[model samples]
Every structure is written in structure tokens, then in C-alpha cells.
Target: MGPDDPDRPVKLAHAALHRAGEPLAFGGGVLLAPGTVLTCAHVVNQVLDRPDFAQERPGALDLLAVSFPATGRRRLRAALAAWLPARRADGSPAAEGDVEWSGDLALLRLLDDPGPAALPVGTGPCHAGRPAYAWFGSGAPSSIAAVLVQGVTERWIVLDSTGSAQPVVGGYSGSPLWDRAQRRVVGLVVSRSGLRAFAVPAADLRELFEEAGEAVPGPLGVEDGAHGPMDPVARQLLGPLRSVLTTPEALADLAGRFLAELEAEPEPGPEPATGPGDDRAGVDVGANDARADDAAAIDAGAIDAGADGSGADAGFPASAERLVRLATARPHGAPTLLALLAGAARTQEQQSWIATTALRVCPEQFLTAAEHRELLTLLADGTVPDPRRCAAEALPLGPDLEQAHWPEAVAELERYRPRYGRFPQLLRTVEFAAAAAGPGTARGLGAWSEAVAKRLGLAEILLEHRAQARESAERARERGPQRGAPAPVVQVQLWRATGTEHFSYALHAADARGRPLHRSVRDTPVPRSRLLAELGALLEEVTGQVEPGAVPVVEWFVTGEELDLAVDQWVYRPDELFPGVLGQDFLCVMRSPELRRAAFRPEHRYRWQVLRSGRLALVDRQDPVVQQRGAPVPVCGVALCCPAEEVPRLRAIALAVGVPGVLWLRPADHAIPPDRVRELVHGAAPYQLPRLVYEARLTESPDGLHRNLALVWDSPDGHPETLGLGDPRD
Candidate 1:
């Protein structure tokens, strides 16, 4: 075979030696230096052992012959060569006494030169999954089969052969698997399964050979005809058949037939290459056409090499070596410099550098919309480290773009976003945008809408408000409440009553005569003293009822001495006293003629119950069970009363019912204005009650208790009222 046969296969074999009576043993080797041989330390040891040293048979321990099919049936003796055991890849002895089995390799030095046709050494590393061939055989017509290295091991290799060929049999050892393209021996087929086999990498074998003072041969091309053996059947069929078919007339006929076939085949219509520009002048049309005709079509990919071939394209802004040098510069400015350079261009080099720098600096800048989109495309198409790094670096840049840009960014982010929603930055960015721009602006509202989006997720709140406003305006136009429309008047009845429905008073006011004022009802039960004191103080001011000698007194009912007494107080009617009342006030009076006429029932109990099983019961003071009625009543709602011993339990009950606060009513010495009372009871709750009471406390009084009443109110609104019930002079 010539030195370039397309079908030529390489062989990787092992050499073994059997001591006289001992069983046969073999060690791994490769045909690196052509006719020369390279084997493991154990192989060399077997070759050196003598028959007398280990047993009984004669000639069994004789020097074995090494041969290749290309050299015919001639066998070479092992004794003619030197053997070195402990040598480094540089052909020097390794560190003294460092005969470690991990580097279990040895080299053979042939006494005579093996001439040319030697197997060459390979440089660089091999990538995973690249197709490879292996061989295992000896002499002419030796057993040879094609195999691929499956895995590399510390001592042995795992391999796989296409056909059912045994990787290891008798007499097939220490053969090299030559890489046809590089004309170098890349691996040594050592172990074999029924069809699968493994070869030790040639790079590793070469190091072992060089370490033992042996010269590595130049690569033997595939046409070197160095394959070991073939099946007799295949040989006869292929050999004679091939020779008979090679006649000039036959060749001409075959060529003509092939040409006719090519002509007969349908041709592909030309396709317009869609791109920004036409840069196909330098492209090899023949190669492209061939590729187009092949089963796989040609695809334009990201260009790494420059138009002018200088070196293998680094596909980066700077050479990786240069970048490394810069990264290791004395001033340590490479990261910043690289970042600046990345911003200047959008080349592969710049992208690479930016990605690299981002790993150390701010990754967010490089992971921009354009770069991220581009990187995603590259990654999807199976680009390596660069794509991997691009993806990794893109992670830190939060999804903070506008709503329109979010879909694309999120699509890119989806590749790496955590399944459990742990990406806080992504969530935050989406949320912030939604909150600032409103939910309408936030597109793609889904379960994964950012936390901010969820927070502002009130659907079309503003739109609904606007629609309502429009509807209101339309209604106003249709049914206008004007001055001429029946004077637009309303009559409201205001009522007052003494303790728990003993007597009652009522006044009716019309909008026209009484000047209808807007009102809000807030149910707040206050101490009766508080009401009396407040009303008395107000009467004192409005009526000028100041007396010189008599002690000022303010009663629930102002009659006789109550009118003469100068009680500097203010009184507030129930409706005027509280705002935001959720229920009607329970009123009782004994003196009012209206109450007497109505036959007011003092036995009737009025109370309010909350949804959560809490109750507030009202009882008249004049009733027989006044104290007991006011005792711890199993109430079903929030209660507001003066600050008392029972308040803590009520507060607890209110809290249990989720009523935010309670109003605690207390007796008052002086009247508090209706406005101030409303302010106190409007949203009164327990905790806020003390604060209100403190503010209302008389600061001038050293002994705090004598000042007045301190009312504690607890409600969601937290309003509280306090009135002074002590002697104003003291």
C-alpha cells in the first residue's frame, strides 16, 4: 500500500514473554518508532527473564520476534535493543528511585536502525468523542481489526470496535494505532472485549519511549500498509475483485457511468444567502457545493478566523495568551482595561474578554440585551467555553429592562433561572417596574410575575375608578339635584335618653330650617358621668350658670340645684359625642315626659354582638341589677368603656375576635366638646387609648389620679376621649 491509502488501518499491540515452564504473561506496548518497539515496564521485565530463572521447558524463553505486515514475514529479535525502565518524557531518568507503577512505561532501543516508515509522534491534546482507530496484531497476515478507544484508565484502556473482533488474543501486543491524517501514532490498542477494545494514548506512550533513550519515529501515513491481518474470506473477495475491476477500460467505463449518474441526479436550485453583505469571494465554491450536496447542508456560523489567515482564530478581542499576560500584569489593571475594551466593540474577542472580566468585575455590564441575546444563540448552537461563560456571566445582570424588553430577557434568563424561584434580582427588577409603571404596563402577568407585580396586582384598579367617575358624572347630568328640585331638603330626628331607656328626648331638624350638616356615626359606649360632665361644663359656659357658694354639679338630668350649681363642664349629646357609630346608641331616661308617655321599658336589654362571639350589653343604672348588669358580661363583640379592671380581658377578647381595639369609657368631671369626643372615639382601640388618655391628662396635677377621668378606647381607628370630673377650683 502507498503511504496514503484511504482504507488503511493502524495496529496497536502488546508484547509478552513466557519463562520456560511458567504460564504466558503479556505487557502493553505500542509501535511508536516504526520497526522499533515501546512497551510497559512489566513487558520489559518479562522479556529479560530467562528459562532457568523460572522453570523447565526449553526455547520457551527465547527472545520474541517483533514484525509488521508491511515488512513481510521477517521477524526482529528483542535482544538487539536496549531497554530503559525509568525515564521521563524528556528522555532523562526520572527522580532517583521513583519507579512508580502509575508511570508504568518502558522504551526499547533496537541495536539496528529500523530505517524510514516509522510511526510519528503526536502533539496537543485529544478531545472527547473524536473518532479514533486501534489495532492489535503481529507479523504478516496477523489478526487486525478496527476499534475506538472508549475510555482512558491509569493502567489500562477501554475500547470498542465496530466489528466482532477480539481486542486481545494470543501474540497481538505492542502495536500502535496510527492517526492517518496526522501521520502519527496516537494510541496503543491494549485490551479488548469480544468486539470492543481500548488503546493507551500515543502521547503517553511516546513519553515512555523517549524517557528510555529511544528516538520516536516520524508518523507513518495510513498508506504505509502496516495493518496486521484480515479475514481470509475478506482478503480473497476484496483483493481479487479489486484488482480485476482496476482495468483501464473498466476504470473508464466506471468513471463514465459515475459521471452519467451525477448528471442524472437532480440539481439543487441556487439559494440567495440572506445576510447583511456578500462576502463569499474567498469561499471555496467546490467545497461549499460538495457540502451542499452532502446529507448535511452548510450553515454560516460565527467566524473565528480572520479573512487573512495569520493563525488559528482566537475568536476573542485579544489572544488568550495575551489576555492571560495582561491579567497577570504588574499593575493589575487588565480587568478594567479589558472591560473598557469590551465596551468598544462587539467582536467575539471582545465578548470573550468581557465575559472573562465579568467573572471578576461587574458582570451586569457585559450581560446586556444585545450581548445576552447573541450569546444565547451561540449557546443553543453548541458553542463551548465561551457560550458557557457567557451564560454564567449573564446571570448576575438582573432582569431590569422595560416591559417590552422583558420577554426577550426573560426568555434568556429562563435558561438559568432557578426552578424554585430563588432568583431575587430577577424578581425584584420585574416587581419594581410593575410598581412604577402600573400593572397595565407590565406585560405577561403570570404566576411568575415578579413580587412587585404581585404587590401591585390589583387588576385595573385605576381603570375601574375612572369608569366609576365617568358613570357618576353621567348620572349627575341625567338626574341633577338642583335648587329648584323640591328645595333638596331632608329631615333628620336627633334623640337623647337617660340611663338605659328610663326616659328619652327627641328633636327633629329639617335641612331648610336646621341646616343639615354631614355626619358620620361611630358606636362608642362611654361612661354616663363622662356624658353628664361634658354636658354640664358646656351648659355652664353657654348659660353662665356659675354659682358662688354651692358646689358645682352636673347631672344626667339638669333640674333644680343642677341648674344653679356652677359646674364648669361641657356636655355632648350621643349623636354629637361619637362619630363612625356602627350601631344605634341605647338610651334610657326616667324624667322625660316623652319616655313616660312611651311607657319606656327599663327591663329591655340592648346590646351589640360582634361576628366572633363577643358581646356588649347595655343596662340602665336605675335597674335593680345595675352593678351586676355592668359586671363581666359574656359579650360577643368589641366593647368601649371607661378604663376599668375588666378592660384587659375585654381587650384580649377583642384581639381574639380580630377587633383591633376597644373603647373604654370613664366618668368625667368636666365636659368635653363634641368635636373632641368624636375625634377620641372615631377609631379608638385599646393600645392607642392610653396614649390618648395620657395626652388628655392634666399635666398641672402632680397626683395624676385627682385630675379627671382617663378614658381608654380600643378600636381599629384608635380614638380615645378623657374628661375632667374633679372640682375645677381645687
Candidate 2:
């Protein structure tokens, strides 16, 4: 039948049987054929030997009863009829026989009618490739699967049905076989493998009937001009014979009636297979069968009581009543009920009873927005803990919403506030608001901020406010009193003698008495040789031409800590006139002062005194009056030329001892005239040299020309005195 045929049955139409006390069970033509049944020997063998059957009932020795469609009530009836025994020829008890050991097929004769029509049998045309329909029951439904005849034997016909082309579960030992074209019984279902299915041919059944001493029924014949069977006339029949016996309208009407009856009735429970040797002596088979029919009525009453909450349905409780009833009555009711409820909720209408039943039956399937909201509220209020927990776990947010959905989500949160008054919900709301505002705008942020402020208390707020205030103060200014101040200025003075190569610059700072300050060298690349020459000339001019009776002083206001010796030392020249050491007589004055001071000590009775005018006074030893009136004598100026390196120290000492000037004496040829030296020193007057000189003395060469120069100066002097030997060869 087509899937939509209303008269088509959705359940199995055949019954199976086995020896009640043995482990043999066979199914198929037994229900249709009362006295004679066809079955595969393998089915009988399985039940006769199976351990579970033997353990359930011990004594097995006779007839077997069969039930069609093996549902719950049917199985119960079969179980109760297990005591029935098979009868012998004289109506005596018969022993159970194992049939599988015999061959591939078997036949049994019932003692009484099974209340059904005799199974039809047909003679095949023996075509090798004709298609046939096979029916089998797996204790479930009877389904027809296609098979093609591969070969024919005297008793068995082999069919090709394997892999995708395999027949539907034809392994059931007694399943029926029918001709699809004529819709009539053709053969009994039998054995199958990957390559072929084997069936008991109708001719074999005829032979078995003759062997049992029964007359074989003639095949339903066709008219002289017709090509098919005519008995029971294919156009008037239904079921496997409907295509051949019935008209389309009749079939449709019958199918519609069958469907209506099926819908009205509740599903039956499972049934057990019947076997031979069941006790039937005290059993009321008729009354038990009646109860089996009433079982469906009882199931329906249970469903009604559960639905209406009557509390009288003894088989069902409130929590599971609705689901059980719906599942029992309708195969596809669960999803339909839930869908209707969800639909109603979408339209903002009241939820119907069917919808609620669906949700109770299959809550996981009802995942609509309204249902979700309801579930959340229920969860918060603890109304439905189990379902609420399930919804929460399964329906977390996924990647399917738009940005605008967040506002709706917020509204949902507000609506459910009374239900889910937990900290997590509040926190999540605040976090969502902050994120939605994009770190810039304050939109929807007030609630979050207020929540936090309320939660954190005032102390935290005050601490944060103070921290911000301090940060503002720090950023307001770039500098402070302790940083980036100007350096102190130091006053320095320069002096030298006329015609001398020695010159001095003094730093008179109270903090730096002995050391000469150094300054930064300019970035310009003045040649080293030119710099030395200029420095030498400048030294000569400052030291050579100093004025008598006044301290030579050139004041410089220096910033920064140290001075540049190379630049500061070059500030004074030997031949330049200053109010300090001057002329050749200045050196004589410097040398003579030591000798005069030594003689005028208290131990020498103050014999003589040296004066600033280059004059020395002599004292009498015993004449007090003459010693007191000692007159000064003037000495002619004379140059004692030394190496250049000795000039800085000598000039330092001279300036320290208060000498006006001192000349740097050189060999006569090496020295220029005082006036010429003055001009050379003046030419380099702008250059400043270091105030203190560092001297490295050397032994004289064999020719008397000193290879090293020694520098002399006091700690307070402006520059060092350098003295060197003249070239001896000259």
C-alpha cells in the first residue's frame, strides 16, 4: 500500500508460534491459515534450544498457540495459553518435535480454527527474474521489501536481495511471501544471506499437505482469456490481494476507516511469543481475550484522568502524567504539542493545554524567546528547578544576535529582576552596559556607575578622588625649586711679565684656591700646532710686559664647576703689560726675595729686606742705628732663560709672593726683543690658557739642551711658569 493509503495497516498482520515447553518459535501464515501453517525450520530450532525459554518454563511437550501483532495484551494472552498441548491422531497428547534438524521448511496442523481465512497459495511461472514482495514481523510492524527470483528448485526458490537491494528483515522463519503484481500469496518466507533469499515454494506446501493425508487445494484459476487468478476475485479483496481484487475507491474508503480506528485506540504494550506445551486445562481463553481488548480502554481512561488532573489515574502521577498519556496515545504528539504552545506564546496568547503537555513532554524542544524568559523567571523564583537548570545550561548566548538586541536583553533582565535577584545578574547587567557604551559615551552607564558606587562605599571614592587631585598637581608644572637652577659664577684674574714666555691666570674663588678650572673645548677644529704656537705667544705677552707696583689682574666671570685649562691658560701673554710682574728685573726680584728673606730672620738679627722695586737693603750686624736706617740698592735686570715647561710654576710662585712681574728668560738667540715679544703676545691676547701648569722634568741632553721643561707656580697663581734651556749648538 502507498504511505498515504488510509486503509493500510501500520502494524504486523501475522502471528508467530513455537513449542511452549521447547525453544522453537515460528511466525507468519499461522494467523491467516487456521489448521495449516507454513514456517522455516530454523525458527522452530531457535526457540527449542534457546536458554532463556528453557529457564522460563520447564515442561514442554505439545501444541503451540500464536497471537497476531504481538502487542502487550496479545503477549499476555499468549503467555496464559502456554499450557495448551498439541493432539495426536486419536486426540491424544503429542510430544514436541524439533524441526530445524530436518530441513529448511516445516508444516503444522492446528486442532481448532484460528478464526481467520485460509492463506492463499499460488503457482509461480518459474521466471528467473520476476520481482516479489516479502513480509516479516520483527515483533514490530510488517513491512514489504522487494526481492527478485534468482533460481527455482523443486521445493525452494532462491531470491537475489543483498546490500541495498536486500529484502526487509526476511530472516523471520515464517514470514509470508506475496506476488506484487497479483497481490496474492505466492510462497512462504524462509532463509536469506548476502547473495540470496530462499523461500518455501507453493508447490512444496502442496506436497506437505498430501503427505499429511489431506487433499491439496487447487490453485485459483484465471478465465480462458485472462492472465491471472480469479477465485476470491482480485478486484474484491483487500490487504495483499487488494491490488488484484479491489477497486481504488473501495481501497481508499477501507484505509480511511482503518486509520480512524487506529487513531481512536491507544497503543498496545509488548507481547511475548507463544510456544508448544503451555498449560491450557484451567485457562479461560475467552475471558482473557476479552480483558486484552479492554486493556486499550483502560489506557485511554488513564490518559484522560492524567490530563484533567483528576488524581484518580492510579497508573500515572501529576509530574509525568501528561507526557505518558500523550506518548501512549499518539506517536508524534510531543513535538506538535510543544510547537503549538510556542506559537501561542509568540502571539502573546494564553498557552493551551496541548502546548503545556508538549512542554512537559519535551521541554528541550520548546526553545522560544517567551519560553526562555519564563524559564529564567521560574529559575529565579525556584518555581521549576529542574527545567530551569536545564534551560540555563543549554541555551547560553551564541553568535546570532545584533547590537540592538542588547536593549531587549536589558529589558528582559529588568522584568525578571524579582525572580533572579542574585549578585551575578546585577553584575552582568552593569558589565553589559559598560561594554555597550564603547568606553567613550556615558549612555546606559549611569545604572552601572550607581551600582558600583553603592557597592564600594564612600572611603574608596574619597581615596580615588585624592589620587586624581595629586596627579593633577603633578602635571600642572614642568619644574620645581630643587631642579634646573643656574650655576654660580667664579671670578678669575690674569697676569704676566714683559719679554717673558711665562704668563699666569688666577682663579680667586674662595672654594678653588689651588686648582685651575677647565672649560669645554669649542667644536671647531683649530689645528693642534697653531693652538700651541698661539698659546706660547699669548703666554709670553702676558708675562713679559707687566707694570710695576700693581697686581696684574684680568677678571673673568666663569659659570659651571670647572674651567678649560687649554682655553683659560692662554688668556695672558708674557710680553703684555699688566699691573703685575714685568720686565727682566721681575725674575731677579723673584730669586732675590728668598735670599733676602732668609737673611732677615730673627736668628740673623734682621740683616736685610727685599723691596718690590727690585732693590735689596743691607743691614749692619752691630750698629743698631745703621741697621735700622738700611738703604735699598737697585740690581740690573738679567734674564735666566730656562725650558718652556718651567714657566707656569715660576710665575705661580711669583704671583703668590706678591711679585709685580717675572720674565721667562731664554737663550739670547731664542728670545726676541721685549718689544717684539710684547707684539707677539698681544697678537694672541684673546686666547685663554689653564691657570695651573703641570710640569714633567727631564735630564739635560749631552749637548746641554734640556729635553724636558719644569713648570713653577704657587697654588693661587693665574698660570704656571715654564723654563727651558737654550739650544746648546747655537
Candidate 3:
């Protein structure tokens, strides 16, 4: 075996050490089974956070919390099952002064379901001068550390980081010691003294298990030469998905996104630092990943140098590969990933293959593909569904409800609580990998979904929407700006300092393509009523900046998950003959500086340009089939076709995967006919929406749609920050 095999990562999962807690990682341990971990007894002591050393094994797991560091912060609760304390020559308890001690091995049993891809352990000989590797924990970038075997003692192998990039330090305890030459974990790093570290060899571990009359774990098979192990049946099932892959980079990208979904969302707080043996990375002294110090991480860069030119570690993204291998081996892997992509209607043959090969796979999985697809479909182009809301409660869900009866489908839907960014953020994420799986994946999935939705109990519309959004998301420019000067507009800057949700805004008189109006008054704060009054006065003063006959568009820049701001309801002048509603009086829109901070993505510009051409889609949330009725138009803006409280957020996401103008009515008490609302907002050019609504509001019908109209008209071309949009959070 050669050092730096990309395949080494497959085995990294076996270096399961750490209690499920902060500072990630305990001392390294080799995974013996899906639920069992083996490490040093002292390392276990430290991981439990008992200041003084206790040789006795934990009596129960009630107090234990174990998690693999490479797997983010989610805890995998566990308990100590076996304990072999260090002993002196006379069989007395070993002391710190003892140069050589025996039997410092322990086994841990997981109380929680660890999912698929348990670590596969391989044995390697303990030899001096051999290269060794380890990592602090998982999920973090570049945590691998390399070292060399200095010498072998009676009970331990010594390692030195003399010529390595990083050394064995405080947090490296209990981490698996991978033998670079053998391509398998050879020992557990027991303790460290500055540059020198001590580890119990794999032989010692086997001896510990055997002396207790336990069966020694057999060696796992490694195939594909250096690319590493994969379930053969899974590999067969995914043949189509693999064939459609454009590049290894694409696969890696999907894998990264999948892993990112599992980790904690980035929050405003201090996170533990990186690097092995770093005190904060672990919970206790001598902790490898946590204070247990299970830093069995291998050097990631070493993956670049595999046997056949590809890095051995470069085979698959470690976490994703592990999950695929683990889940699909039981045959649930592919289906779980294909959450919204599965269905017999889309490809009955593919679905049937799993049944034919059911006996062939282990770690079995069951799926309700159509139903899963249905839930996702509803999410794709429509409103956000409450996880607890059931089909029995949905009106006109259509009669195609058979798939909803699929075993565990609704239960699975209820279980889907995503920590990802926003509403369609889930839709975008789930569909990305499926789209890359094969050509027509989007189309096939859409058709099956549509069939289900036609009667809808909701399948077809969702299918089509997901396909369009996903395809468009990819085609959109990742980064760029719109061409030409943005339209004449008034820019509003709403700044709320950290530690508060209340916002303070300023109105700016912006000229097209001019400098960004930067204003943040973190120190001087005002009440909501006073701020709105001041904002109203400022808006009145800035309306003069707008060219004659052009509507004054007020674009407010806000950030984070803030969605409910009554910016449109503010009264510009309460004392005047007409104290007009801000949204009704002018073109008021909300712009997320955080979302648009990168400036205008091509999608933003693409739609903005189309709106310039007067093409807009009128979509009724109640019955949106009209947009699909006629030939597809290059619509740049969308008529929200309903009141503010009524439109699905996915509609906003669908108009443009990046950014596009949206127009709707403010929350209204009375419903208007869809045709009337459409003819009113949809008939006018996208740019003329504000003026049309303004004129209509002054009509004799004071309760008309015009009085309640609201437009989120954001065009990168005429955006407030034609200068620059640098978010304060950035």
C-alpha cells in the first residue's frame, strides 16, 4: 500500500472517537462495528471530563454523548462497554511515571442509530520509521496531520512529527494512527510529550478483545485498487447517474453540498478553532477530536497522489461516499438521496431493479418516491407547506392521492425539517444532484409529479416547476452585473445593527448608474413610529429626484430572514389631504442586500432586461395554469396575482433563481377575481406597474386592487447600489 491514497478516506470513518459535544473529538478510536468504538482506557477517561484519572469503565451510557468529529456537531450518544486499564509489571495500577504500561484499551457502544457507512478497520504492522497520519476531526477543512514512527516499545509505538507539516500536540489523543505504507489504522495515539507521541498498536487492541474471550474483528476487503470500496449493487444501480456525470468536480460539488446540509448553519458566534492538538478542537487534555483527542485524520492533500495518477483519497467525497456506500448497501442509500427524484412512473424498470436486487443488498432502504416527489413538487413552485399539514387538509389536492398512501411517505414528509437557508433553498438543493444524475431527469421527474398533481393530490405542476427552476439555476451567471445604467430610482437603506431586529432606514436620491448610497446609523436609534415618520418625510423630499412622468421607485435594502416589513403601509404625510400608503403612493420593493451583495448576477440582469421589454408572467397562486396555457414567454417580471399574505414564497424563487421583479397586492380583506387582478397588473409593462397601480388607487373604488397593490421591482440595471453592495455582515 502506498501513502496518500485517495482511498484512505473510506477508512477515516473508522477513526470514530469523541463524545457528542463541543470542541469536537475525544481521543481517537477505531470503529469495530456500526455501534462499537475501540480506544485507550485513559483516553475514554479524559473524554468523560473526569479531572482525575479513573480506571473503571463507565457503568452506563445515560450520561455519555458521543459523535464523530468529521460528522459535524450532531451527537451520536454512546456508552463504554469494555474497559482494560493500564497495568504495571506486577499487575498493579500503572502510574504516570511508568515508562511502559499494558492493556489501555476500551470499547464503546452507540445507543443511537449511526446510519450507514460504519468504519472498516484494517491491520498494519508496528514498525519504526514508518509514516503515519491522523486528523483532528471531520467537517472542518484541512485537518489532516502527518507523522513518522520513531520507535516501537513493548506495549506502544512511538511517533515523532520531526519532518511533518503539523505535530502531535494537545488534541491528538485517541485519534486513529493510520499506517501510511499499510493504508490502514495501525494504532491509537495514547498520549503525547511535546514532539513525541505514544500509541497502542493494533496488535494490542486485538489482544485486548481476545483475552476477554471476544472474537477479533476480521479484516475488511478493499477493492477498486486505490479508489476504495463501494457497494457493487449500489454501483450497478447508479450506473445511469454516473454515466450522466459531467466531471469529477461536479460530483464533488454535489457531495460538498450534501455534507453542508448536515452541518450546523453558520451562526453569529465563536466557533472552535482548527488544527490538530489545538486545545479548543477537543474537550479534554489528550483529546484527539474532542478532549478525548481522537484526531485520526489523514492529510487531505495526500489524496492527490493515487496509484494511477488520481489521488487515492480523490475517489469520492468522503462523507457522501460513506453515506452512499452505507445507505445504498442496505439499498436505502440511493433512495434517500433520490428523495424527490424517485418514482415508478418515471422509470419503473429502475424502481423494479431494487426489488430484483433486494436480496443482493444489505442495510436495506424503503421509499415512497412519488409521494416524496409530490411533497417536493408542492414546495418547488408553490407555497411552503407546513410539515405537520396533511393532504386531508389541503383543498383540491386532486384525486391522485394513492401515492400519498405509500408506506411512511407522509411520515417521511413530516420528518423533513431542513436547516438550509430559505424556502426554495431545499428545492434547489434536493434537485441539483438528481438533475446531474442523467438527462431528462428533470423532465421524467416532472412528468411523474405532474401525473400525480393533474388530479394533484399535486404532482405535475411541481415536477415542471422544479425542472425549470433547477435548469435555470444552473444557466444563470454565478456572478456578474446588468448592462447599461439602471433605471431612475430612489434608494432606501434600512440598517439594523447586530443584536436587534428593529431597522433604521434613510432615503437617498439616486441617479441611474451613480455611486452607492452608504449610510448606517448604528449609534443613533429611533422608535418604529418616529423612524417611519422620518422615513416618510425623507421620501417626500426625494421624490423630486425622479424624472417627470416616471414613477418614484423606493427599493429598501434589508438582510437576514426578515420578510414581514410594513414598508408599503407607512404614511408619507399624515397631516395632508391624502395621507397615501407608501406602497400605493410609490413603487415600493424590498431588496435583500445580503442576497444581492455580490452585485447583480446574470439572472438578475437577464430578467431585469426582459422586464425592460415589457414581458411579464401573470401567475395566480390559486390557479397558475394560465402561464402554462399559452406559448412560453420570456417573462422578466411576475404578477404575484394575489395578496401579500397569500402568495407562496416559491413563486418569488421561481420568477428568477437569482433575482427578478415581483408585483402583488398588499394583504387584502376582500378577494378580487383573478382575471381582474391579472388584467390590472399583468396588462401593463413590468416597468409601468407602479404608475398603473398609483393611478388606479385614486379611482372612485377606494377598495380596489390598486389601493392594495405592492410591487417588489428589483432591477440590477437601475438598482440603488449601482455603485456597490457590500453587506455589513460581510
lDDT tens digits, residue span 130-231, model 2: 576665544334355677766555346677765324454544556766555543455666655655667765434544545545443333211211112222
Which candidate leads the pack in TM-score?
3
Model 2: runs farther than 4 Å from truth? Answer: 1-13, 18-27, 30-32, 50-63, 70-103, 110-126, 137-139, 142-144, 163-170, 211-730
Q: Which candidate leads in lDDT?
A: 3
Question: TM-score for all predictions?
Answer: 0.26, 0.23, 0.29
By TM-score, the better pick of 2 and 3 is 3
Task: Please list the Cα RMSD from the true structure of every candidate, rounded to 1 decimal place.
Answer: 32.3, 48.3, 23.5
lDDT of 1 by residue, 1-730 (tens): 5546542433222233333343443443444444545654434444556221222122322455444445333344554343334333333434433322233344444444443443423322221233444333432223445555454444345556565344455334445554444434555544344565555554354444455455545432122111222212111122111222333233233323322322323235244353533233122334444323221111122122324433232221112222222222212222233333334434553343233223322212213223334333432322122211222122222222222234455444433332112222333333323222323333332233422222222323333322332343343345442211111111111122333411121111112112322222212334545534433333334223222221111112222112111122222343454521101111111111111111111111211111111233221122222212222333322333423444444433333333322333333355332233334445543223333443444233332222332221222210111111222222
| Pick by TM-score: 1 or 2, better one | 1
| lDDT tens per residue, model 3, 647-674 | 6463445433433556665555786654
| Candidate 2 lDDT for residue 519 | 28
* Alpha carbon lDDT of each predicted model: 0.32, 0.32, 0.48
